[model samples]
Target: MEVWLNYVFGLRPRNFWGLVCIPLFPLLHGSYQHLTGNTQAFLLLGWFILMQGIHLFYVVTIATALISGVGAWLFGPPNSVGVGASGVIYGYLGFILMYGIVSGSWIALLLTLIIAVRDAWRITGNKYNESQLLPVERSPRMGWTAHLFGFIGGVLIALALSDMRLN
Candidate 1:
């Protein structure tokens, strides 16, 4: 099943159309666990991004997808097909974290800080490590590389928009 899916829909390194999978793969999930994890992160971070404004939301979303997708296609494992929304969520996380820093908004900074602390605590205090602070690449199936690249993508976009005085 995994082999079949990777061949067809997974993001393969150096594959041109697989580049399309960069944006599209985030919309796919390998299992219920994968879907729920991405959903929670997306909803929370997405809310904050949405608060910035609807137009910015669309802008950031598209930017994250393209940047994150391209990064994965260029640097991801040769034989693997990356999938899941962790990249986008990580992008959102990066945007929030950097936007606060760039804008010098105390409220945004505090909000980002709180989330950081909370995630750290969750990872440290949990008995089973149920929650993670950063997206950790635990399985060959989990695309943590995309998460990382997506985060970098978000930070870059936020930096680019910092001078616009969006805050």
Candidate 2:
């Protein structure tokens, strides 16, 4: 059942049918490890976003998914089927970090710092042995493309909303 869902819902780059998966990819995971790996970060970051408000939470989530999904679809490795919530996780990371910077919120900044310190190893660790000489030369299984795009989307959304008063 897991494999079947992943097969049907995973993001397929450059395929018209894959477009539908933009909203669905984050809901699917390839394995137990994959799901667990994303769950912690997703919850942590999502909680911070939710602190701002429920409406903003939905906005950040939906926008980040769209931007990250489209970006992965455009630049992801050919024929790769991407799955997992890492993109949204990364999106949350980006949003919180950028929001802290842009909004001058000490709480946001402190939360960002806490997350950075706690996850520093994961953020800096090299998952691939190769130097990744090119942006596209990533492990097809890693969803680095989704991470990158999702981070960008999060930052963009944060910037877009920076002017608003946030809690």
Candidate 3:
């Protein structure tokens, strides 16, 4: 059902309508396998974001989704449908990473570094890394475009919001 919803609402690369699907994209998944892959990042990152504050969490989530969707829609492979929360997870990762540097939060920086090393290690050894890296462009495969865009989005949002009293 969610998958079907994804087909109906997922972001279409280079399509203007994709903007409408930005917020919705995070709510849909390509498959159970895809959903499962994203679940841990979503929960863990989401928890950490919430730890900052409910409002910050909401702001980061929505901003990342919108920015990620725009990025995928504008720069992703044409005529393709992209859906998943991995982008948002990437956004969370980016937010934490940038938050540490911008706000001088050592804990956030350390956590982001640890995650990056772990994921980088997995990609280096895993035969499936290529597929995961360009998943959306490859068709019926895991793509990292959303993740990249989401991370960028998160960084942008964090930069914009870090000055606020977001404690």
Best by lDDT: 2
* lDDT tens per residue, model 2, 43-105: 878988898899999999988888889988998878888888777877887888788888887
Please give the CA lDDT of all the candidate structures.
Answer: 0.73, 0.79, 0.74
User: Sorted by TM-score, highest first, which candidate order results?
Assistant: 2, 1, 3
Itemize residue pairs with steric clashes in candidate 1.
none
Instruction: Show model 2 residue runs off by greater than 4 Å.
Output: 127-140
lDDT per residue (tens digit) for residues 31-80 in model 1: 78778977987888888889889988888888887777787788777877
Residue pair clashes in candidate 3:
135-142, 135-143, 136-143
Mark the regions of model 3 whose C-alpha exceeds 4 Å error after superposition: 1-3, 121-125, 128-140, 164-167
The per-residue C-alpha lDDT of model 3 at residue 42 equals 86
Maximum-TM-score candidate: 2
User: Cα miss at 43, model 2 (Å)?
Assistant: 1.0
Give TM-scores for every candidate, taking all chains together and pairing residue i with residue i: 0.83, 0.88, 0.82
**Candidate 3 per-residue lDDT over residues 90-153, each given as its tens digit:** 8887887778777766676777688777666322225454324334344345556777788888
Clashing pairs in 2: none
